[model samples]
Target chain A: NAGVTQTPKFRVLKTGQSMTLLCAQDMNHEYMYWYRQDPGMGLRLIHYSVGEGTTAKGEVPDGYNVSRLKKQNFLLGLESAAPSQTSVYFCASRLDRRVYNEQFFGPGTRLTVL
Target chain B: EDQVTQSPEALRLQEGESSSLNCSYTVSGLRGLFWYRQDPGKGPEFLFTLYSAGEEKEKERLKATLTKKESFLHITAPKPEDSATYLCAGRYNNNDMRFGAGTRLTVKP
Candidate 1:
């Protein structure tokens, strides 16, 4: 089972341009999360969803929005891309992400803002 | 502020050599400690999970141990396949999981 998958393995955007990242999971997970990793910085959560129709902001949510329309998909949107938004983005899923659930991560999407 | 830090940003060991990596963390509440192995340009792969102090888990050449304030990943006679960035993360009871910058390890022949 392709535990988790992300669309557009790589992307390049111009300042002010808008884009959305798609994350899909086939494990029927109860939780999904979006995080960004920058050089010298650890992965920081941008947003997360506990279930379909429920979304919450995480550690770093500025410049981003998320939607969980389907139980199998989570989308991260950038309204106006900036250089600061350029980083490697990762998506993760967990069957029960309540307290100590172990997360399964996708391959990751590398973004570059020019 | 919740934080996770890993020591010896990077380590190089001869094949068959043994070593250990350190991870220290601070959070509102500790629920679990996670260890992952990440190859360059790839996503992290889960290794072991320690739920509380005195908890330990082992896989092949890796053994993970947890304590109140820190965790250690011990590698015994590691092979080149063990060369990767080791990441330590913590999950709080509230479901907030934070990661460390990662300690890169290189097992040479």
Candidate 2:
């Protein structure tokens, strides 16, 4: 069902350059999240959407912005990329915010900023 | 601060060897514990979820057990296909989920 998919599997950006990452899910999930995984850091949430039009900041939301204008898509934007922003980003979705619901993750997008 | 830590950052075992990976967490209140398997260059895949102490779940050759402050993922008769990073997570009262650094397991044949 293409549970979740992210665009541009890999990307390289120069400092100050801006770009947006697209995330899509066909599972009709009620919750979606954006997280960055750095070596030895596991995954840290950048932002999340509880529903189609609601977005909220998470543990590590600085330097990133997000929009969930549609029910099936979530977008993460970097206004001015920096070397510290380089990492593997993942998008995940869950049927609901219930504790028992397991999150489904997309392949991930690797970004490198110089 | 909520935190999740996994022990034995990496492990290598023979194809038929059995072992357990540990996940220790500290949170205000526990809601759920999760286990995920991830391959190189890929996102994590869900494996099991345990809700409370004494709860246990099994899938194929893997079993996950939960306690008050920690969780354990037990692998039995592992195969090469089981080589990957195993992640553990904990959901707290505020719905914030914290993940561990993950245990990289390599099962050699």
Best by TM-score: 2
- Candidate 2 at residue A88, lDDT? 97
lDDT of each: 0.92, 0.93
DockQ of 2: 0.76
- For model 2, how does the per-residue alpha-carbon lDDT over A1-114 read when each residue is reduced to its tens digit? 888999999999999999999999999998999999999887999999999999999999999999999999999999999999999999999988777898899999999999
Could you tell me which residue pairs clash in candidate 2?
none
Docking class of 1: medium
Worst 10 residues of 1 chain B by lDDT: B89-98
- TM-scores for all predictions: 0.97, 0.98
- Best-matching candidate per lDDT: 2
Fnat of each prediction, in sequence:
0.73, 0.77
Model 1, range B20-102, lDDT digits (tens) per residue?
99999994577788999999988888998888888999999999998889999999999999999999998875555889999
